[model samples]
Target: MTSSLPLLLLALCSLSAAEAQLTVFNLRASDLPSGIVVTTDGYVKVFCGSASLGETSVRNNDPNPWWEEKFTYFQGQENDVLRLEVHDSDIFFNDLLGVCQRQINFMREHDCFLESGGLLHYSYTLNGNNQ
Candidate 1:
């Protein structure tokens, strides 16, 4: 009985640990239009426009090159923030003439701009109501 008591206590502890779980709520531009809002209990809500929705992969210059090393990995139950990307149409020109004339100048001045690879990254907190 004494030997079994320790095993039983260990099992109960593991079960309790499993109950305090962390979950992720991922949102993208494709999920909804500009007016829609998403909520998470312990995380910040992110909104990305349609132009930024598509397949997302690890960023080229990401410090972690592994497939699972992106922002999504950091999501947890408590104290999390969501990330979002939106399109800047004024800066991106569709025509070559516009690109040569205005877009180039904008790019040079800004030094960096968001690209439309068709993906939006977002994270949300998980709580009883939002989960």
Candidate 2:
């Protein structure tokens, strides 16, 4: 029927190009307006290019901090872009509290992605995809 619908839409675009499972949950930061206090234990750094898939565990003097991070990737494509950086845990200098990105096919077609900086709120979860 209609040439088998172009081979079933190329087998559903090759099963939506598989490989996924990116969970970073409950990472919070609320009610802010206190600047110029650099060095108060804070962490969150996840990148998916040049490989540095790890971070989070430095929450002292927390400003609504709660990092439940998890990451896994296996040949992730669709212009992979999941880079988040929010740091304040400094011994000499490490204060960068802003940065967000999302483009693993738009987090696997809106499976998950809620990124924010400055009063942080970054929760991205896309479990199951491959491309």
Question: Which ranges of candidate 1 are over 4 A from the true structure?
Answer: 19-26, 30-75, 78-131
Q: So what's the TM-score on candidate 2?
A: 0.33
lDDT of 2 by residue, 1-131 (tens): 35788889999998876566555555655532235763246777878766778888878776566777666655555567777677777668877766666675544322222233346666555556542
Off by over 4 Å in 2: 16-21, 26-40, 50-92, 95-126, 129-131
Error of 1 at 94 (Å): 18
Q: Tens digit of lDDT per residue, candidate 1, span 1-131?
A: 25788889999777554421222234322211121232111111222211211223422222211122222221232333223433222224311100101111111111112242223333323333213
Displacement of residue 35 (Cα, Å) in model 2 is 21
In model 1, state the lDDT of residue 18: 43
List clash counts for every candidate, in order.
3, 6
The lDDT, on a scale of 0 to 1, for candidate 1 is 0.26
Cα TM-score per model: 0.26, 0.33
- Strongest candidate by lDDT: 2
